[model samples]
Target: MSNAKSYIQTVALRDVKCYAFHGYYPEEQLTGIYFLVDVEVTFVHTGDTENLNHTVNYEVLNTILLEEMANSQKMLETVVRRILDRVLDTYSFLQTGKVGIRKLSPAMPGEVGHSFVELSYVAPK
Candidate 1:
């Protein structure tokens, strides 16, 4: 059979809230902060969508999110990069993936809602 039947499937986990210690300052590191994470991935699939095996499991995604969030990093870039890398590595059929992490109520003098970073991946053909 031709590959014409193949289609792309996307899975996303949005606004995943977590409390973790991640910041540039030592004081901020000592005190944990709330975070919001969003993960989205698209994959090529030609098989029937009848089972979890047919697509990426979101539970696994959440687990990865929580695990990465728990690990304190100095930069939001590092955290988001790790999450994106993990997602792309986990699925062999992935076409593209994106991960965004936001720090809520950052340690800043001025009124700032949040600071964030986003990382994305695209599999080479």
Candidate 2:
């Protein structure tokens, strides 16, 4: 257990996809868009990170992500910020975390793969 990076656990939800009406263009709201999110939190478990009480629940995070993504927002940055705020606030014990959001199919003239917005946070020392 000594060399296994024993204490720290990285709780993550990867490439969670959802449909939403969020963009800079008007048609984007009417037709909607695809949003992909990835969230990760690194922390030293107080008791056990695998346990329900000691760790952040995936369902709760999914709910938060869906609720935030449902609203018609103008920017991916706003979406990412709100998700991070809610998660970090709810799980105050987390030492550090990151939130990544991508507009999988942004409306554009040229062929654009995706628009990415990411936010990272570390609790004050």
Candidate maximizing lDDT: 1
TM-score of each: 0.92, 0.88
**Candidate 1: segments with Cα more than 4 A from true spot:** 1-4
Q: Tell me the tens digit of each residue's lDDT in model 1 across 71-103.
A: 999888999988888877788778899999888
Model 2, span 39-67: residue lDDT tens: 89887866554569887887888888888
Error of 2 at 113 (Å): 1.4
lDDT of candidate 1 vs native? Answer: 0.89
Off by over 4 Å in 2: 1-6, 47-50
Show the colliding residue pairs in model 1.
none
Total backbone clashes of model 2?
0
- Cα RMSD for candidate 1? 1.8
